[model samples]
Target: MRGLSLKMLKKITNPVLLRSDLLMVVLNRDSHWILVVLDLKAKQICIFDSIKNPAHKDVVFKLVEVLYQESESFQSFAISEWPVIYVELLPRQSSSSDCGVFVMKYMERLLDISDGEWSWRQYLNWQVEMNVFRAQIAYDIIKFGEQFAKEPAKDTKFCNI
Candidate 1:
């Protein structure tokens, strides 16, 4: 199926659809989660699969088609010509069940890197470092909500932690 159904967008309350930035998607195929990022600014779609396989090319293409359609429909932007780059050089999971975690970590590191600092090699050993990063994320969230928004505004409530 190409892009998400229009009904899907309607069901999403206060839909944050088309910001001028990379859009990340995490999808489950047969209970295995994988990551796909649409870089609108770069005109590229990057797929990060922890388990490398030829079948993932089909998944990537489908996602590209879907995103291209959705982008036009949602924001009047056409991304049909954007190239899809299969990132097969990511840190492969040693276990069968770490796909979701791998996707999340991939996203985290991707977002953390600055312009001109991106390299798949730098993110190696992520599986081994996952526990520490997980705890750190938990701590950061408990300290500050949603991108570390400091000082809740008057009439806004925050959970006491």
Candidate 2:
């Protein structure tokens, strides 16, 4: 996973330095998804895993090192030394297949939160609501695809069909 992350970093055309107050990364390890958020303003990394594993902290530390080396914006601050917070109190998934959904919901909730204040209690019952969330996601994707398909082709001369 570490090697894959470094390769991904090398392939990025746009560096993530100072682009936003928060940087969100979804990492897949052994079929499980984990959400990692780099809070630039707070100088810390927050890990949101449905399973709540302590090992993720070490993995994030290595990734942060690569990020620090690759970007000039991190040169002034010790980003690698930033605190790695494992958000254990957030919602947990009872089933293994829901990790990806949990990660997506985590991102959505994070974006919806105002003033950096996170309320984990609101998502405590997410396990029961997984099916509803899954349906909503699928509906949104199909709706987006339908909307995109409605747009006229830019080069209509290429193919009539």
Candidate 3:
């Protein structure tokens, strides 16, 4: 899995992403999906948990362990020096089922906002209006699928799953 992940990441041609200023991962914790944002710029591991009950330290340790095991490509990946900040005060899901959607929205908003002006203070109040955002994402995915159907996916596979 580690080698497959590294091989997949190597396909990225973007210089900024190769440097990986911010690495966002959606993790499945007991059927619940949560967002883990590694802010390499600040050297902080930020967890945006929709339930606001994240084991920040344990998650950080686990992340470091995974990175260490996968350290061949991630030569500079050292998490001990970085602090794990559980961002519980960010947008929260009203119910138990919206965690996956919340993670996607959180990543989308963060990437969109980061491209222009980004301030943690301003983003704290950034609400996840699920009704509209979910529909928008679905439509976008459908459009993307249509465009993707027009072209074939390149030979990007390294290992057969």
Candidate 4:
């Protein structure tokens, strides 16, 4: 099932009715989550086009990084679009339970963030390795609550964030 085109994947958001041996992975896109289906028997990956609740991006990003980092063939997965996600069969000999383990890792990471370290380390090292950028944090914080001005005075391009 390799060499599948990006075009073919775009139409696969169906409820994944075929297999009980499936592994579902939901990763974030700044705000919403995309569900990825792994067909354990076929060794193929299917990403669903779905959007979900907005929560903490940092924690979600961390989860994705750790999962990809540990997967042996992870580097070969294709992700061209800004919010594209990767899915693949749970390696043939492995148990589908590992998928739950992978998701739990993210939940643990989120709990850690809420502990209030009060120290913000540049997420750069992990970000660089995982290829994700947190460039919007400073802006997101600074402009988080102001009302959108309907009409800014001429000659001024107002940026909310």
On TM-score, the candidate that comes out on top is 2
Looking at candidate 3, the ten consecutive residues that score lowest on lDDT are: 117-126
Cand. 1 Cα-lDDT: 0.68
Expressed as tens digits, the lDDT of each residue in 37-106 for candidate 4 is 4444354544532222233334435433543444333333321212423323211113222333334333
Q: Which parts of model 3 have CA positions greater than 4 angstroms off?
A: 1-18, 114-128, 153-161
- Candidate structures ordered by TM-score, highest first: 2, 3, 1, 4
Q: What is the lDDT of candidate 2?
A: 0.80
lDDT of 3 by residue, 75-142 (tens): 45556567778885577777778888788878877887745444455555434567777788899999
By lDDT, the candidates rank as 2, 3, 1, 4
Candidate 4: minimum summed lDDT over ten consecutive residues — where? 88-97
lDDT of 2 by residue, 102-121 (tens): 99999999999887788889
Write down the worst ten-residue block by lDDT for model 1. Answer: 9-18
| Tens-digit lDDT string for candidate 1 (59-145) | 667655665455445334455666778786788888788787788788888888788456888667677876787787788778778
The better-scoring model by TM-score among 3 and 4 is 3
